[model samples]
Target: MLGTVEERVQSCPECGEEIRTDHRFVPWCAACDWNVDPGEPEEPGGRLEALRRRLAREHGERLLAEVTTDEALRPRRDAASVLALALASAVHGFTVALFVGGVLLVVLGWGGALPVLGALCLPIAWLLRPRFSRLPEDEQVLYRSDAPELFALIDEIGGAVGTTGVHAVAVNGETNASVSTYGLRRRRLLTIGLGLWEMLTAGQRIALLGHELGHYAGGDTRHGLVIGNALGSLRTWLYLLSRIESPTAPEAVLNAFYLLPRGAVLGAAMALDHLTLRATQRGEYLADSFAARCGSTEAAVGLMDALMVSGSADVTLLRESNALRGHRGAAGEAESGLWDRLAAHTESIPASEYERQRRRGALRGHSVDSTHPPTHLRRSRLLAVAALPAAVTVDAARGSAVRTELSGARKLVARRILNGG
Candidate 1:
């Protein structure tokens, strides 16, 4: 998604309808009532107290692992959903063409050939769209922009967590993040929202990114993307069928004959999507665990607060601003084309308005088929994961220890060079 040029001043997060700024970065929005920056550390309370507060703040809407990553969840992407979409699309197209041809055939008294031709065309088109439409790695990278700082951090975290290199990272406008894998080699993509950056404290943002990368560490991205695309095809087919009744007319009759079967194809596709979704949700917890293991549980807490603050703040502003204009927010805006628009709405609402719809309860949690899980669930899961035991903490003591290790290593190297040993 393209970023809008800073224009048309609106209410500030701290003071509404008074001042506007081009900068998207913010630690807190006082006027809008949100919190993105990491909160001040709580006083030394018991471990349980910290955990309790985190849970109370989150309200139990967390993502949990529902399958084994190495087995059940890994194979989903390349299996059938992609093919199903292809098949459904071909059928839909052929059915339409046949309907058109049938009309001509009826006029010409050539009824026998019309249905046969339609059947042949329908499945072929359905199969081809997905085959041709597979996203290249570079295109996936373009979905969100990345910065060098973030990349360095990912590299550090990957080493700490003992994973292969971080795959892909991008920025969207929403207060969200996700991980996905599409095939056998097990490469993964990690995405974060621009709003997430605007809302989170530096430490918290690191924790959040680490959590997404954790999905890769746990092995999800290689299969998830492919499955998602396949299920998407199913959704498209079923959705079209659900909208029609008859094929008597060019649009109607073709829809009637092709859509119903395609919808069935989607049902299976949706099931696959669900499996991936469930596994991904679980993968979130593993990433969280990794982040906590890296000595940043407080960062996890800060991430949650940032999500709540950013989400509430962004929505309050966007909704009110959109309300003044008397139109649905960007989500309601028409797409560039049918396929593009359908894919946009299907994939996820644009980042520009995700928090707004999410806040208003307009978006369903499970019913959604996007790379990221819902914001609320993400926040809660982070909090819950923060409660897990950790191997280290991001404290002054830890910093000193690392410094000591480096100093000792430097001294030993210097002596070796000096003594010519």
Candidate 2:
């Protein structure tokens, strides 16, 4: 400073351009026009938050307009088109037949042996077909007989959401809940996270259950699985193809030729996936709307707030669980200790920090690959809907029993995680 030192140059994290500035502070990149200053902390609820709020408000307005004008959230025809196209592309029968024809032509000496070589390549590619499987054995499953109170609540929520009974319920060691279809008949399986369940109130729990069951009520379970599986298959195939190698020059040329058509197919499949994703986004809003209607709007909103807070709460709980690995407590005592640690950690989080977390959540946006809409958008959509009374409620006694049952499951999951299972 005594000699008026020159400013240092640094690489911009965003654009990878060299940032040169004479100023001692507030450095910025000219290439991408992004701030390159590493010293400055980001402002709380900055421009991104403002932009997200505006967008959410506008989206909410449009949704309300559509509800008033169209009478319902109309199904997207583009999604159906995408599903059809994906199904058609997945059928490789014609390509197989062409490979067979090429083999025949080469066998009869109608052309060079290249056709037979290409036909042989088809079998290699077929052998490399991506295999898909579902694994639920690792998760802790709970039967209705095991947790009757929890089952009763699920039944109540299912009834309110106009769905048949869930096939089974499982405890997932996370801060979220999901409903998925399994097996040939597509039986609905519900997975509830103990971390989340522990933090929610009875009303919030009803909203949570209704929200997941609402996916089934909206036909999302079946259609979403189909589109998701198709897209996953397309992505996996592309990844496998990209991993394929050619050691020789001729093989490299052949591989190049093969990839040309394959790339085009993958591109088209990606476009369809994009369209399907849009429909899925709409489905998420619809599910939120359903949840708000089935439970009180306040409860639904509270559940979302809980989701934002649960992330931090879950991390804190997991850290505490890790510290209890070598403890020689009895089974029930160990479980109680885990819950006690979780509660203390959760309560220790200050109100201001929780508010900050909520603000951060509001600014968070979903990527194209994400299945759900952003938290802020979901909140806005629910706020736009008319308020409704809660469809179901659990008495304190029943709620306590349900929580006790969940605690047992939570202890099992915690033990497994801490034991590095």
Number of backbone-clashing residue pairs for each candidate, in the order shown = 28, 0
Residue pairs that clash (backbone atoms under 3 angstroms), model 2: none
lDDT of 1 by residue, 1-421 (tens): 3234353345555555343333343333335534322334434243323433343233324323232222222223443435544544554454456456545555555566765665554554454233322223322242213344345556777776767545555334345776654344544556554435444444565576666666666766324434444444555545555545453567776766675576566556544543344444555556666665554767775565455445454443343334334332432222112123222222332343334333422234432323444555554544543254433334555444433433332333222222222
The Cα local distance difference test for each model comes to 0.45, 0.63
How far in Å is the alpha carbon of 190 misplaced in model 2? Answer: 0.7
Tell me the tens digit of each residue's lDDT in model 2 across 1-421. 0123266688888889887654423456656656422233333253323433444444544544554344355344554655655563553444455456656755765567776676665664454333333438878888788888888888878888777768788886678898886776677789988777767777887888888888887666225544555555555555555634645888787677777767765665545544454455666766766677667889998787777677666665656556566774643465556655555555554444444444444444442114556675567566666777887877889978987887767778767655544
